[model samples]
Structures are given as C-alpha cells and as structure tokens.
Target: MKTIGVVDTTFARFNMGSAVVDEIKQHVSARIKRVTVPGIKDLPVASKKLIEEEDCDLVIALGMPGSKDIDKVCAHEASTGLIQAQLMTNRHIIEVFVHENEAGSDKELAYLMEKRSREHALNAVKLLFKPEELVKQAGTGQRQGFEDVGSIGM
Candidate 1:
C-alpha cells in the first residue's frame, strides 16, 4: 500500500487541514502520516522530513497564506523550499494553498479554503496512482470554477 504524507499548518481557520485529510482518505486506501506546523512558513521542512525520513510515497502540503503582501511573499518562499525538497527527494509534493484574500468575508474564505484543500487532496491522490485522469481533464474545463481554455496542439 502507498503511504501518504500530509503536512498542514495550525494558523488557518476552519480546520482546513482536517478537511483535506478527510477528502484524501475518501479517495485513497493507504497509510496516512501527518505533521502539523505552526504556520505556512514551516511546511517545507516538515514535508521534507516526512518524505526523506518517514518513507512516504507522496506528500500533501496544505496552507493558508494571510491576506497581506508580506504573507504572500512568505508563501512564495515556502513554496520555493518545497520545490527544492521535491527535487532532492525525487518525489511529488502537492502544494495546496488558499489565500485569505481570495474571499470577501470570513465565512466565504473558510468555505473556499475547505473546498480548495479537498479538491487538491483528490488531485494528489490522482497524481500518485491515476495521473491519466488528470491528463484527460486538461483543457476540458472539468475543474470547478475554471473555464475550458481548449487544448494546445503540440
């Protein structure tokens, strides 16, 4: 069985991490190992350790960046670190992020965060075992809230 590593933050509202874990479990039959950090900036190291030391087959890194300019910058830095970790470990990392400013109100943000995290968790499972499903959806507008841009000819 595959082992899934989940890395989440405590700073987000609405318990988005738990929503993500629940969604992942619905689609995958695997061992789930989770690590919770204090904030978004800490996700990279925890994810790296989960992959490098904990022997996980895949990783889901979930976080909610604040609505400030500095927060966005910090998220970018954390993402870069995640990329580096992926290269070092030769494994896939699904970095799921929901910005606080994406919604107009606290309630909306909470809903959006939960929805986005669950969607990305499903994406992570697909990436690990059924990547062809994702490729089939390219340019089809099958994703929620996204428009079909049409496929490009190679």
Candidate 2:
C-alpha cells in the first residue's frame, strides 16, 4: 500500500490535515501519516522526514499565512524549502497554502482551508493512482477553494 504524508502547522487556524485525511479516505486505501509543526517554515523538514523516514510516497504540506507582509515572506521562504525538499527526495509534495488575506471573512477562510485541503488530497490520490486524470484536466482552470474559471475557448 502507498503511504501518504500530511504535514500541517499549528499556527494555522484550521485543521487542514484532518480535512485532507478525510478526503483521501473517501477515494483510496493508503497509509496516511500526519505530522504537526509550529509554523509554516517547519513544513519542509517535517515533509522530508515523512518521505525519508516514514516512507511516504507523497506529501500534502498545509499552511496558512497571516495577512501581513512578514507572513507572506515567511510563506514564500517555506515554499522554497518545500521545493528543495522535493528535489532532494525526488518525490512530490503537494503544497496547500491558504493565505489569510484570501478570504474577506473568518467563515470564508475556514471554508477555503477545508475546500483546498480536500481538493489537493484528491489530487494526491490521482497522482499516485491515476495520473491521466490530471492530464485530462490540463488548462481547465481548476481552482480548489474558489469557483473554477473553466477552460478558455480556442
């Protein structure tokens, strides 16, 4: 069975890890491992550990950046680290970052978190089991948390 890792940050207001796990369980049967860190910057190492030590085939790194310039910078730094980790491990890390400023209200923020996490979880499943599904979706403007913009007419 394949192992899927879920790395989340405690700094996030929502429990995106649980949302991802729940979505994954609905689609396929795989070993799901979860790790929690203090902040987004910690996601890279946690994800690497999950891949190298826990034998995960793929990872979903979830984080929420606050609505501030410094937070955005930190998110970018974390994203860079995640990319490096993926290069070093030669594995896929599906990043699910929901910036606090993306939503106008608290309720919307929570909804976006759950929706994005679940959608990315399904993407992970498709990547591991049926990558062709994604190929079919290429250029479809498939948004996770918001309404999909749809494909443009030729």
Candidate 3:
C-alpha cells in the first residue's frame, strides 16, 4: 500500500497537517504516518526518519512562519533541509508553508492555510496515483490563497 508521511510544526496554532491528511483520505486510500515537531527546524529530521524508517512513499511538511525576517530565514533553512532529505531518500516531499503575514487578518490567514494544506494533500495523492489529475492545473492561472503566478516566461 502507498504510504504518506506527514510532518508538521507546533509553533503555529493550527493543525494544518491534520487538515492535509483528512483531505487526502477523502480521495485516496493510503496509509498516513504523522509526526509533529516543535518547530519548522525540526521537520527535516523527522521527515527523513519517516521515509527511511517508516517506509513512506512520500512526505508532506507543513509549517507556519511568522512575519519577522528571522522567521523567514529560519523557514528558508528548514525548507532547504527538507529538499536535501528528499534528495537523499529519492522521494517526494511536498513542503507547504503559510506565512503568518500572508494575510491581513487572522481569519484570512487561517482560511489560506486550510485551503493550501487541503490542496497540497490532494496534490500529493495525485502524485502517487493519478498524476494526470495534476496536469490539468499546469499553466493555469488558478490557485488557492493569493492569486496564481501562472506560467512564467522562459
């Protein structure tokens, strides 16, 4: 059976990883192994362990970064580490992040996180089983949270 490893940080008030798992279950039947770390910095090690030890097919990492410059720097470091983990394991790691300042209000930020998390979960499922489903979104100016970036120039 296909397995997905979910890694999230507790620095944020929301349980975004749970939201991703719940959404994935709605459309796919895959085993989900979740591990919650203290902060974004801890996600990489936990993700590596989940794939190497737990035998997961893929990993989903979720975190909420604050507005400060230091927070962004830390988030960047954590994301780079996650990428390295993926390279080492030869598995996909969907890194989902929502900045606390992405939206103007708490409600908006929450909504963006929920929408992005659920969408990324669906993306993970598609990556595993129905890759064709993901093709439909290519180059489309449609996305959750902020406006879509669409296809950039070559």
- Candidate that scores best on lDDT: 2
The lDDT of model 3 is 0.91
The digit string of per-residue lDDT tens for model 2 on 21-131 reads 999999999999999999999999999999999999999999999999999999999999999999999999999999999999999999999999999999999999999
What pairs collide in candidate 3? none
Error (Å) of candidate 1 at residue 85 is 0.8
* Residue 5 local lDDT, model 2: 98
Highest TM-score model number:
2
RMSD of 2: 0.7
Q: Name the TM-score of candidate 1.
A: 0.90
Q: If the candidates were sorted by their TM-score against the true structure, best first, what order would they fall in?
A: 2, 3, 1
The Cα local distance difference test for each model comes to 0.84, 0.97, 0.91
Tens-digit lDDT string for candidate 1 (1-154): 8888999988877686788789888887888899999988898899989998999998989888998999999999999999998999999888888888888998888778787778878888888889999997776644421233665655
Q: What is the TM-score of each candidate against the true structure?
A: 0.90, 0.98, 0.93
Output the better candidate (2/3) by lDDT.
Answer: 2
Candidate 3 segments whose C-alpha is farther than 4 A from its true place = 147-154
Model 3 residue-pair collision total: 0
